[model samples]
Target: MDDDSDVSGLRATLRANPAGHWLSTPAPQVAEQLAQTDADFVVVDTEHAPTDLESVEAAVRAVDAANATGEDGAADTAAVVRVAWNDHVRIKRVLDTGAAGVMAPQVNTVDEAEAFVAAARYPPEGHRGVAGTRASRYGRDLDDYYERANDRVATIAQVETAEAVDNAGEISAVDGLDALLVGPADLSAALGVFGEYEHEQFVAAVEAVLDASTVPVGTLATSLDEVDYWAALGFDYQIVGVDAGYLRTGAAAALERYEQVGEE
Candidate 1:
């Protein structure tokens, strides 16, 4: 959530790898330029942004446009939305926009995780009420949408609390979950040790998450050194840095390292 570091296309590209250019950017042509750089998927972060219904809809349109240029048979850089929270209504509305998945935030228990999955799916597989909207190709095909929801749509729960770490196994074991995303700042706060993911206790908690998780587990790692280490430890995916983080860090480094003829 650092500044504008949305997770929309990024999440999808990570899951739908090796299928053309899955990378996409947020609103405006900037996103398309970014998508051109290429990736496996993209994600739009609505949870932290002031993204209202209108804006979310616009973002999806932009991402889809970028995906169109990737190549024939391009995976289309599945759109994903990280809703503001685990609210079912919000989940349904965003999914209605045609996002390929949802990333539920602050899930601290198995029940919360289950509730998230249920909200993301429809009957038999879940409790999400059926609604023929833009997500199902604008209602052109109802049965196909129902049949494929469980398969094509993904749900990733964010494990950012100490209690969530404690119940990682149970939460991850939920049938429809595709992955567990660790939110560092929240997790650090929950553990009573802010900004120190490498601390022994924090590390232990993370290891527990990975060990107990039945699906892919990931977190943000800023530096190349840290990225290599975590990946070596079994994290297959990570955000090098969120968009806002990259901007601020750049500004700070430029000012700090700039050589003003007389200043050392």
Candidate 2:
């Protein structure tokens, strides 16, 4: 499939069934493995992870490779990079890596949201620099990529602060801003109730975002229960699991099993 179609299909999938997973380890192999799963999309998390630009590119390639093989015959999984911040350079470079979308952090105002969208889109809509990068098959598909990028590339702004929640309605209404993701950890901390997902203040803040957003809203869930909780609360989509979380859980489980066998 062409790059544009990949992103277009991703938008459709998210609208129809908003389920995704996260990669925090920055390993291309891990990304490939995850991409081969039945996930609707996979987020390569650079915001909190140690993923550099090169690593991000490799991971994007791995995801593409895995999607091409369809080893398990699962549907194609789009790769979305959650950049470290809402910076123009970072946004442009990562998009060059052929990511299906970008999820920027801490977009707290309408202006910030607009800037985020502008940086991700090309001219006529915004100011993303044109390039013959991997996104365009190194100039082979440049014209086509440029033509469809503004419409196809997903631009997601993270609502992680009290101010952002306050501006959610305006931010969501920004043209070319495709979605809003709640940065639960940062948002809770910003609300002065760190890790208190159930605290009244935090709950109220989240509800405010839900109520205000005109675009699809989503959040990250570290476990199946959290998945159920967020889905129950009506989040349009969710990044359901993190790679580090999986490593920690799986390792702990194996160690516990080993100790049990030794005891027996």
Candidate 3:
């Protein structure tokens, strides 16, 4: 895609809409396939999944290709990558792959959030070193990418710890930090109430993060059933399905169907 091409789908959609859903996966092909779906964005999970930079780059290219030729074909679907941590080198590498954004995990403090934003941005804003990566169209769009990247590229910080919840307001207020996401399972564990979403402390912690956040915030729902509850609570985005979840559910259902037919 050209530097002038509308590569800001995820950012623009988040701005215009109240909430959006994203598909998270570790597989590049699946990432490409889902980008063609109604999902607004696809996030390649590099932290938990055994995904390397090469795989992440492939996924980003897949999203770019899928968006290039879909029905409405505005290439509006975005591809975001969730890095393993809030490190400068990792963040810069992924951003160079032309992703719409990078989601940094375990940002439990304002300083960590600032560091993430700095690494994702360029000079004057931060210290991100520029290279002729695919993001710059191999030096062809170097000038344009340099000028517009800092504004267009998103920097999402994950608020998955009790400490982060306490500092949510400050983190959200940091310049260049685009969004905040509460990692439910991790936060629950951090609160000493693992797997108990309805526990008072778990609920309260989630609410605290929600109340403290000043910018767009998001979280991962265990299932589609929980989406409305989260949306009502003011989450700007929700991740409902992971690639593993989809495969597991589908495989289980198919086996159950086969068993039922045999019993009949």
Candidate 4:
């Protein structure tokens, strides 16, 4: 409801060059801190993180607050929710909480992609349940919100299987689908090469999705080192680091420094 920020820019950014972090830590404060980063957007990974709707809503609020006065100009960081599943009930809950986007994992076919999009949208476009939730300013921004929801809310379908890669084009072409994300680990496993990032078959499957996608494509870089690799491959977006990964890496470095001091 904060009209001052004009977050519609996120829609364009996701379709263009989205680069950001993944909030694997299920905390609202973490979302607030990361939203202030130079990243273009951040996705709260509810699929893997033990995040409930309350924390997810809090995180979404934090993101909006951070973006309100963020120095990134029109490139403000957007908050996306990676819901636990593609179920309409769960997707509707997240949308009602005001997340800028919703990402569903393991979307392996055109029907799955369509279902994801439908859940993210309201009537006329889809059958999402309406409510006077935060997204509509608790009824204050009703008319405007309803009119803009379909256009403003982004829908991302993650392609994480061999089947998804094969049907990437059809999935991407779904009417309301905005983007396709590749789940590298799951995808590689399905291709019979778990963790083999450079295996020929795994690489081919990734390329297959990339080549077939009609929308912006994204994948996890797993580390800061691989950011450019994925980006250079023509990926529209890339998640360079996750909250848990950052925490572990920082903690390990600190312990190493302490050990060096003890040796000295």
**Candidate that would win on TM-score:** 2
Tens digit of per-residue lDDT, candidate 1, span 3-55: 11222233434443222121223454543444445544455677766567766
The estimated TM-scores of all candidates read 0.81, 0.92, 0.90, 0.91
RMSD of 2: 3.6
Candidate 2 residues 166-248, lDDT tens each? 99999999987878999889999998899888888988888888898877899999988889888887788999999888889
For model 1, the local distance difference test gives 0.70
Which lDDT value does model 1 have at 139? 80
- Better lDDT candidate (1, 3): 3
Q: Give the lowest summed-lDDT range of ten residues in model 4.
A: 1-10
Query: Which residues of candidate 1, in runs, are more than 4 Å off?
Result: 1-30, 68-76, 223-225, 249-264
Q: Give residue 123's lDDT in candidate 4 (0 to 100).
A: 93
Per residue, candidate 4 scores C-alpha lDDT tens digits across 1-264 of 113233255666676676888998777889888988867788988888889999899988887777755364443778889999889999999888888889999898888888888888789989998889998889898888888777777888898899999999999888878888898889988888998887889888888888988788999987766786777667888888888888899999999999999999
Whose lDDT is higher: candidate 3's or candidate 4's? 4
Better of 1 and 4 by TM-score: 4
lDDT of each: 0.70, 0.86, 0.79, 0.83
Of the candidates shown, which would achieve the greatest lDDT relative to the real structure? Answer: 2
Q: Residues 1-264, candidate 3, lDDT per residue (tens digit)?
A: 113243354544554443333445556678877777756777788888888998899988988887754464335667788999899999999999998889999999889988999998899989999899899899899998899787678777998888998999999888877778888888889989987877999888878887887777888866666776677766778776677777788899999999999999
TM-score of model 1 (CA atoms): 0.81
lDDT of 1 at 242: 50
